[model samples]
Target: MIQQYGSGEPVRLFTAGLHGDEWETTSRLLEQLSPPRTGTLLLMPKVSDNEYLSTLDRDYYTTYAPHLLRAIKTYRPTIYLELHSYSKESYAALTGDGRFERYGVPAYIDIEAGILMGSVSPRIRKDFFTPNDLCVSFEMPKGPNEQSLSVICSLLDVVKECWSRQGFVAYMSRHYPQQTAVAVKNYLRFYGHLY
Candidate 1:
């Protein structure tokens, strides 16, 4: 079973580590935990931690996806975001389309990159989402390129604010503080749209 938090009008579901090796994403999510009863953000961490021990390089798609599928079917959340880490690339959000959707929400590869470039700082040049749109996985910077603590906090704040106001029925990248803006850029790039 998975864990959850918050429970009000707008439900923000944040998850980490479908793939256990993706420690950066896991660390980040773990660090941001608030009390569950706040009824706002629902967090599910290490969804695949035990399964990954034997599976190795495999992500959550095989072992843990069924649980997620069931939850989405049951709860019907406003948005569902699965987080992961890639050491090589920058960051991305996964959409469900296959680079062919008209609305471009599902399987829309590099949608995050597109959104961030239009609304974020120039320092972040590259990022991509899986095209699923439901999830946002990211690649931490290599060497000295890591974002600052202030920047991370800012990004989280923007995500909370934007999701709260607009809801997830539609796609929109709202305003964020300058420091937090980079995480938005990174999230868009990392979550490119997967199933």
Candidate 2:
């Protein structure tokens, strides 16, 4: 299902659960959905909600692509972040830094068009749609943990910068800053530090 929130120029689309059992993105999006978001946010938590456990192939998910495609055409979003999970090796290859510490720290956000290889939703088939839009396919470990917060936080950092460039920002005035600060404080406290 498609759910929308916020209002402004340069609509943003956030999609998750394209691959079966990959639920981190969906969870995070649902967690942060209630407060009035900044800019246009379109969320499709589960593209193939029915086949979530029975398949991982792109074709299976593509069967339901027309629905999202129609939304894209209608919303004309200028940004997209398709979230998914992948293997640790997949993460290493993307970074090429040989770091296997599955903390979901640094996410891959510079996925170029057409070259479908590593993690995340791989390539969302938005054919000829939002060509100039800022697109990213983010990935996490198959067995996600609390580290997923780091990934989400990092994504927020990037999105803030990118959105600012396009005159689009999320939750700037709605205690979003305080929420982020609290998250940081909580993280520090969890790690046994005071901030």
Clashes of 1: 54
lDDT digits (tens) for residues 16-128 of candidate 2: 67655666435455446552345777787766545453222455434656676676677877776666666666654555433224432222322322111122232342343
Best by TM-score: 2
* lDDT string, candidate 1, 49-104, tens digits: 55343111133333445564455555655544544444433333323234223322
Alpha-carbon RMSD, each predicted model: 9.7, 12.0
Candidate 2 ranges beyond 4 A from true positions: 33-37, 50-62, 89-126, 157-195
- Model 1 stretches with alpha carbons more than 4 Å out: 35-39, 50-64, 89-149, 161-195
Q: How much does candidate 2 score in TM-score?
A: 0.56
Local distance difference test, per candidate?
A: 0.40, 0.50
